[model samples]
Target: MTNHYYRDFLIRNWQERDRIPAAEVIRSVLSEYGLGWEPNGADKDVLQVEEYYLATGGEFWVIEYQNQLVGTGAYYPIKRSEKAVEIRKMYLLSSVRGFGLGKYLLQQLEAAIASRGFLSIWIETASVLAEAVKLYESNGYMPATGVETTRCDRVYVKSLMTNFY
Candidate 1:
């Protein structure tokens, strides 16, 4: 389902070949905010994208710029609210900030989740990620609780039942 192309960037489904570069991109982005990549803890999914995402009812995507893996975003059905899905692993390289790619990827994820019959979407993020918080809030993700990750301080949810798209 590689249908998105913005400027010179491309968004496509994750492949086995993307594992290493994708992990590098994710770790590099996390390090920018003084966060560590917890492959055995918070980020265990990155190491098992097949089992945790694709093998389940979820999808994971990789972002490419000039043929280089630069970002990632994914969502998996969670036992949360009605038909809920948790948006996870959204990260972009520092050089790609302010380019609207994050917003585009988020919108794409929402569309996919809704199309898959998900009624609500949840996101857990740290307050340190001011831009991410702003993006989610601006896109109608209201404040919520139940943050399960140790690194995250907040959780936000958007009800897709009211969304026309």
Candidate 2:
């Protein structure tokens, strides 16, 4: 099944057409990660691609299946930094896992980041997301230690130029 399935996926910078599906997929993925809940009057906590679009000139890629959104990923410049970008808010619907979509997304994100003159990229995922960690490792990202953050996340970093095929 994995080899036979091909995603009708299109990745682009955020646009008005993507508002609802992007929001819903983000909410669903965050819920799966236990990070979806938002308190009343805290709508700002929701990470909307459109909002990031306006703020950081960030780029968003949405995966669609039969015209329905099923996955997304984004890249944004890190603040106070030069030539560095962060791969943020990457998620795919559960049904799409194990078919190499994650690898594709990572490669696309790295390409986008590098195109913008960024020399390196980093991502932080929950330590419990072992599959994600392995994906990063297999893609040449090294585990980063001693990152102090409240989220207790596991950090991974990779230099974009080191292992290009």
Candidate 3:
């Protein structure tokens, strides 16, 4: 809704009830791709907010510009893996797609995750999200074999270290 020239959007932490709007954007976008994300089911984390994202040594950021939420990105350490973090819930409004906000959010999230001492950032995206796959590929993410999840098919990993394998 915010259509102003306010330079770069600001990334803010997801506060209480903040997930409502974020979920709206996410569900709307996912529905466009014929995907389903149920809040009380598969995406219960969005409902719990702090308990799932913040309390766990991870972060969720909402991109706001001129007081309107436009995008979101989140990360948390992979289960049972101390050296890796999983990138999650990246979505941007259709009106703001070509503005490089997705790339910006990825770069920023990578930096933040690395700074948290994570050696790698992991991502799982659907085969349908070509632009997202391209963004991750261009950002130095390598296709990786990992735990199979029903949420997505393509898996990518970004190493925060040069030779930490």
Whose lDDT is greatest here?
1
Which candidate has the top score in TM-score? 1
Q: Write the per-residue lDDT of candidate 3 for residues 37-78, one digit (tens) a residue.
A: 877765677677788778888888887876777777888777
Of the two candidates 1 and 2, the one with more favorable lDDT, higher being better, is: 1
Q: Is candidate 1 or candidate 2 better by TM-score?
A: 1
Model 1, 1-165: lDDT tens digits are: 655898888999999999899899989988999998999999989989999999889999999999999999999999988799999999999888889999999999999999988999999999999999999999999999888999999999999998765
Flag regions of model 2 displaced more than 4 Å: 1-6, 38-51, 145-152, 163-165
Candidates in descending lDDT order? 1, 3, 2
Q: Candidate 2: lDDT of 74?
A: 77
| Full-model lDDT, candidate 2 | 0.68
- C-alpha lDDT score of every prediction, in listed order: 0.93, 0.68, 0.78
TM-score of 3: 0.88
Candidate 2: worst-modelled 10 consecutive residues by lDDT: 37-46
lDDT for 161 in candidate 2 is: 66
